[model samples]
Target chain A: MNATPEQVVELLRQTNFSTLDWAIVVVYLCVSLVIGVWVKQYATDMAAYIGAGRSVGVWLGVATMTGTELGLVTVMYSAQIGFTGGFAAFHIAVIAGLVTFVVGATGFVVAPLRALGVLTIPEFYERRFDRKTRVVGGVLLSVAGVLNMGLFLKMGSIFIVGVTGLSPDSGALTVVMTVLLLLVLAYTVMGGMISVIITDYIQFVLLSFGLLLTVGVAIWRLGWENIFQVVAAEKGAAGFDPLQGEGEFGPEYVLWMLVVGLIGCAVWPTTVARALAMESTQAVRRQFMWSSISFTARFLIPNFFGICAFVFFSTHSTEMRELFLSPLPGGASSAFTPSLYAMPVFLGHLLPTGVLGIVAAAMIAAFMSTHDSYLLCWSSVITQDIIAPLAKSEMTDQRRIFITRLLIVAIGGFLLFWGLFYPLEGDTIWSYMAITGAVYFTGAIPVLVGGLYWKQASTAGAFSALLMGFTALVGLEPVRQTLAKTLAPVMGDSETIAAALSAERCGLAALLLTCVMFVAMSLLFPDTRPDARQRD
Target chain B: MSVWIMIWKVVFVIALSAFAVLAVGATIGGARDVVTLLNKLKQDRSNTKSDQ
Candidate 1:
């Protein structure tokens, strides 16, 4: 029998939360709270709070960094990508790791950034070039970071609402969102990097165990052959083929993922802060390389999960279609929650009681680890890097800590609102990230490279590169939509303007244009010689 | 196959040398000591530069 939506609903209904699941989430939450608060005892000063006192050894940093980069979204999205596109998603990990290695090896970003002792990426811009550059870069990074985070609150709440058996639109999503955000803010605001690093370490441990459990269980239930067979028959050539499955979105859709993940990987302020947290350039290189390895392992896991989801759903499509497409008010078709519910379905059906609890704990751990670090990373950048500079007197560490906490709450509040209203269209979390990332990655590249290599890369040049990159990236939405509408009648393709313009070629084109403009503008208006840029 | 495994093992060992530093950070005291040491290094470098 062909898979139907009814079967999917049956599957969803069949997989209700058990006592074991509750135990897992509760134990994990308690452990997280303890680990988080415990780190505060070591946080004596601002540096400890912000940068692990720059004493973070390479392994711990690598482990934590890998864990942070691969959060709940990674698990969900990688699986979604795998389910749909198969090996193509796997290629992305390989591509991302290789680029990371190249950049770390060649001093593409790290060397100059580390040497500056700056707290945020924009601070580097401000110091290397001008205030205008800092402001532009800062604003862009924040917007991109926040908007990209739109899914986190919604997804987190969805997980809670789904697991707890609350209807999707039950007003409880907001409450769950508030509670989780508060938990992250509490530890992050208290200890800064100290709390962040310590909690991240603990989180890394739990998340790895969770991943292993999931992988092991999936293998056990389906057997490798069964999983592969299902995926092959269901997804057909397109599912297994790395290159197919463009659908209504077109090729630019997939290409954008690669561009954004690769470029934006280095562009985040937290990443730079983590790099600077190390003791030496050698340490920075080592941390990132190992982190890359950890990332490799972490990245592959998601694709595996994604592929598994595809197989599972394809085989059970009849059930899912009925479950999802039924006339339920405020509830999306199971497809809306497919990736979110993928693991839950597997756990409820496949695992025995004790093991199920442990895996669920791991899942929560994975989510919290990423969320806490993000809170710590962003708040620190805003308070120490941006706010303090604007203040007249040197703010005390106490004041700084207070402000960072306040900002975390403020940012969390803002995200709560966004998550509540913003609807998910397409597999958007990653796409939004990629598009925004192109802005940051390409923008920072010119200024960073010029700061290191080109003697003639004036402050004006840096400023212009930053401004142009920011403007171009931020402006892409309108320009793309307009272009899409304009071209819609001409070309019969149903592709949105965003998808049409996001081709890898378009991304590369933007990169080239930005680089040339930066050079031209800088030479036309010089700020500092390359020799002068190196202070000592 | 053995040769590839051997190569990876050697790489892992080298990576462990770096890992040793991070392991030190596991302990609160050890992490603090490392931070203090880096600060001293930064200060010494600055002092030497000024002397020159």
Candidate 2:
């Protein structure tokens, strides 16, 4: 009684997506392209190209920040969390919002960084520590950032394929990923941050409304009271309480989330890029304060959709139950995991044709907005932080912009390749993203905090902390598996060891280790020059 | 568990409401900001050309 892939496709095809939806999606894509290309006139200099001339206002800043952070990949992963973890997943959203609010109010890391007026975080390293630290920090940031977004194209393509009821075997994932990448590269390379900002504003409007509308429809379809009842019956106490260790999340995971939440707003490059792009440090603070709402909604809304998807699947048919709920026979797996497809498939069935198209377009907007920002971000870091600094001669603005454009295309090509070949075998997409990001932030936290606040933070401390971040790479599933096997003789069981070295635990350990390394190294090798440390 | 459920429900509602206000406010305010940004960029380009 195992369902075949064909049978699963047939069940998925019972969606409300239609020709109208396709047309809507196409029109939206065309508009985004035009706006992105049209903004090229404004990108005449390095600052304009990469930082939108540092002229962004508070509201636009908020919109673009939300647009970038609340990406389609974010939606996919958060929904998966909601579907599997139920109400417990809400804790992550709560933590993200609260942490973001605190950062905004306290002006902890972002405001000071904004006050420094550097284009990238690594640039600050050169100013405070040394040129070598900047190059090392830049390299690590680019590597971790590029790796962090490796799965984005795959997740976005999955959402498109699942929502449109396309056959998983129809080669649609590759097609969608390629087209999306090309489109994002085309505009991002041309208009840079100006293009990113304009499109992000539109996307913010569309995605916010689309999310609210879809949630309203889903609540209507599955009665709110009944939705809770189903979760209670299916998942029990663990569904409601995140602190209940019976669920996917526990105390350790919550602590890790608090750290991740802080990094999401304060330390993450793309977000901090928005802060840097603002008209003033005050604007950066206000933008983050206002963006706290979107931060919460980004996770809370998608997670609700996931819970709804779970309810829909549980009640619908025996076929769905076999596909999604039941354990696979003999540990066989599908080309795509069923849990990842749950929210899009649920929306496919719940929304009517016209609404489905608008929502689909909005989701595509979300995908593109994030892609453009990230592509622009990593490429700029490579140019300004890595290549330009290391160059024997000063680079002209035109040459810098040209190189950045070339790098955007190159990065897009890498994304396509990585998306196709890399197996998404981790427990949750969220955990995978967090751990990948931890490889950068675990080290960055100590360096950024110590450098900004502590006068004693030496160049040696910064280098040691940045180098220590590489230890988090072992948290990746494939690496963890390899490690577990190597230690199996000593540890008794590979599976047990693998499970013991969970992504959250490893990430927490890396953060703690990096912090200690930073402090110890700074004390051991204090800078001799009194003027080395810059004061605010 | 019930308390947890209630807490989530409240948080969800507040988040939704706040986001709704933000969407509308940012949309209107962002439109004006976009115009300001473009004009500023234009001015900067003119200044650069004059200097050159």
Candidate 3:
């Protein structure tokens, strides 16, 4: 008889986590909170609060950038990719590294933006186009950014629950999510970017060493050669070749990854916020170039762990294989989904008590570093780009900071509610993130690149491009499913139609269409007057 | 093994090694940067007070 979902959960709960591990995690959390609160006095001005006084150096910039981007959510989703896609998933890491390196070497969008010395990306929109463009861009960016991170708290909580071997049905997930959010909000609202930068640096150090240690232990335990052998046996050429039509990813996915990679380093607001914080444009370039190593390793290391988890489960026992690989005992109605839990559960079993505690702390560090930066980034954008510009009276720096802190709390509340209620049923965490993120980046790529590079990028063109980004929302799983169901009678099969409207295809089409619209609109109805603030 | 698998193995090793080096370098260098940043903030605060 097939093992029930309850049995699987019971089996998963058997882990090496101990009281010693809990002490280590608690101590680390205390130190991070202390450091964050200690830095509150430094945030006496808007620049210090939001951009760390624009005093960041190259190595620090690289470290903070990695800390923010190599988030727990990134690890969970990348590992899930590896579990499902095998070696084919490594292509995404390679593309990410190369694209980041090129962006650094060329200083494409970052260099010019740094030279302008704007606090946010939408601030640049105002300088190049008009105040209206800035406000609209800010609104779009905040919406997409918040939606993109909607699953982060839940994903982090899932990691904590799995690694600690807590029973998922015992309300542990909700408790963990609430505690992590409260901790992050306490530090972030207190210290703003100053605390964020300091904490990110520390987290970067711990996460790097922790990752290497885990990978080393995994390789030693599983035997490197055996990993390849099993993957080759089970998945065939499709596992190794991303371009294989039967593989998890194909030509279109590879192309889409390239765009995603570019946007990740160059156009993403949180990453660009690092650039804005740097001491010089030269530092920004160097930071990205050096950060390419981290950008690649973040994905590559987690992916290897996922692959290891697959090997472990496959070789461990018959029941293990069935639990992870086979359809649910009762089919799609079953409550358990195994992919996201695989890596954490494997770690909980593999690592010893003390070492497991340290790694867990490091992962929590990753979680907090990402949350603080994101909360600060979005809240500041709303204050500086959206609200400040719209306010009739000139707002004081103190007023702006107060509003930002309040918004941070508001956004945190929304994340808690969304994480609890949102259905993560039909899509992978990574795909959900990409589709939501595309709602901003698809439009941003055109508006940012055009406004910076092309002389004729008008306010109207920018507006049209920014509005066109909403079309990428069709790639969301629920929306796509609804469209597919509604059209099934007329268009043959719902599943086939949904598959045809894949996230990559939709995102790429939206990107191309937005670019064309931007250019056409600019050429057709050029700005009547060249603004004095427009860059050459 | 197929060429694709071999390529990934090589790539993974290189990426991991490079990241290890970056981690060490960033740790030491980032410490000094943190000090420099704090000092700069202190100076900026003093300047603001004097202006007032």
Candidate 4:
């Protein structure tokens, strides 16, 4: 398994392409398209398109949540993380699930928010805080959503093309983006949550089938024990230890993720929309409770896939070093390359032709689900949060729908442009997602908690929290660069160390610190008073 | 993947993944059951109130 250049080349040669692989890819695509087309019957109006008419029961919500959460990049990164960092990377998935479970159990944040019957999280801010606070939250959520979506098309294209052994850099980002948008628009524009949930059920089944095939083939090639041994020998202690490594994230990373997972998970516009789509609080809570199981199961498989890739790559150190150490455009580090390449390499090496195609389709499904939700999420927030609040006219439902679809086109178009042209500099896709998330993750707690608890939390606190959280994220950029430089010698390679550091820490800190600041300021500035229009 | 273990793993994955599907199915089924039960309870309550 220690693949030198010669070994890699030989492996590539041994890997025969069959008709079965092509068949798998074709079949998967056709089925997903059919599902998209079929869901049209459910769409009665715009509300139905967005929230499935608040008709989503527990099962559909849970399934759709799983599908939305498990994106192509998630699988790719998990495999990549496993390939490089060993078992430690699995912690990310574990913590996310456990935290989500805790959130469900407590019924603390989202349960109450869902009970309020508001459309979006930012709308909650408008009701609870001031117009200015809502605007800030809305803008922040939209930007966060857009930036987080920056890599989807590129990453999806990479996975699809790579699995098919086609041109990896097809420069087809725009075409791919358009295809994804059209697919999402077709059903999403129709029945909204109904279409999303119904389609997601089928997609979830197919993806699970595909992942099982991939895992089976890999285990057949190298027994699980052998895989574990190879990885253990290669990575030593740091490989499996989630707490250690370059970031010095240690326990704090876990703690931060737990808090973010608990509070931030519910606050995101995309998820908030999903919660609102449910028929009732009981439905939302029950769906999540059941979802906790599915979430945990899916969580482990991807992490395991990652760990398997790590073990498989260990004996192939020469290739690993080459993949990691190679300079990316804009002086991007090798750390970014190998992990990114891990899933592709694993699929190319392991899967049987028929199963391979199925997996390819599953990857595409993941991409589409993520894209559709993101498009819907940001667009809704923008319309409801930013535009509608500011506009003097009471908007009609028809007008609202028109604006929503238009915003989708506008925002989706921007992402396509950014995805194609955005220089891959400064951060990994994971960090970018997290950093953008911190914009809300850090700011929301004060607003949400204050809205729920303290009547005295004035507009000043909300504004300060928003400003302070953004400042933390923006300020961390230079600090990150300096930290990378300072720790370069000890890290052996500075960029990976730097990339790892940000992914593990900064966002959570910024988010948590913002929460702390909001509470402190609210207590201190008690006399600032509330907006009368916001309350009864 | 061991033959036996692989079979079990496949089954487990399928079961876990089908949760969402089951949720939808159950909600419909559960609602019907609930409605029927509620109706029965209401009829008995009305009859008792009239007799009293």
Q: Going through the candidates in order, what is the number of backbone clashes in each?
A: 18, 0, 0, 13
State which candidate, 1 or 3, has the greater lDDT: 3
> Which of candidates 1 and 2 reaches a greater DockQ?
2
As for lDDT, the candidate ahead, 1 or 2, is 2
Candidates by lDDT, descending order: 2, 3, 4, 1
What fraction of the genuine interface contacts, i.e. the true contacts, does candidate 3 reproduce? 0.83
User: Candidate 1: where is the Cα deviation over 4 Å?
Assistant: A1-10, A104-107, A160-166, A244-258, A321-335, A471-483, A486-499, A503-509, A528-533, B1-52
RMSD (Å) per prediction = 6.4, 1.3, 1.3, 7.7
Write the number of the candidate with greater DockQ, choosing between 2 and 3.
Answer: 2
What are the runs in model 2 whose C-alpha is more than 4 Å off? A329-333, A531-536
List model 4 lDDT by residue over A361-474, tens digit each.
787777777677777778878887898888999887667777887887787678778767765545555556666677666787778777776777877677788777674454
Model 3: pairs clashing at backbone N, Cα or C within 3 Å: none
TM-score of each: 0.82, 0.98, 0.98, 0.81
Q: Candidate 3, residues A1-536: lDDT per residue as tens digits? A: 57765787787788999999999999999999999999899999898999999999999999999999999999999999999889889999999999999999999999999989999999999988899999999999999999999999999998998899887767888899999999999999989999999999999999989999999999999998999998899888888899987889999999999999999999999999999999999999999999999999888988888888988888888877877777666652233568988899989989999999999999999999999999999999999999999999999989999999999999999899998888987798989999999999999999999998898888889999999999999899999999999999999999999999998999999999899889999998899888546445
Candidate 4, residues B1-52, lDDT tens digits: the string is 1342333345445644554455455445534533442344345446656988
DockQ of each: 0.07, 0.89, 0.84, 0.08
* Number of the candidate with higher TM-score, 2 or 4: 2
lDDT of each: 0.62, 0.92, 0.92, 0.64
A154-244 in candidate 1: lDDT tens per residue?
Answer: 6666655554454444467788788888777777766667667766776766666566667777777677767656655554544444455
**Model 2: native contacts recovered, as a fraction:** 0.88
Q: Score residue A261 of candidate 3 by CA lDDT.
A: 96
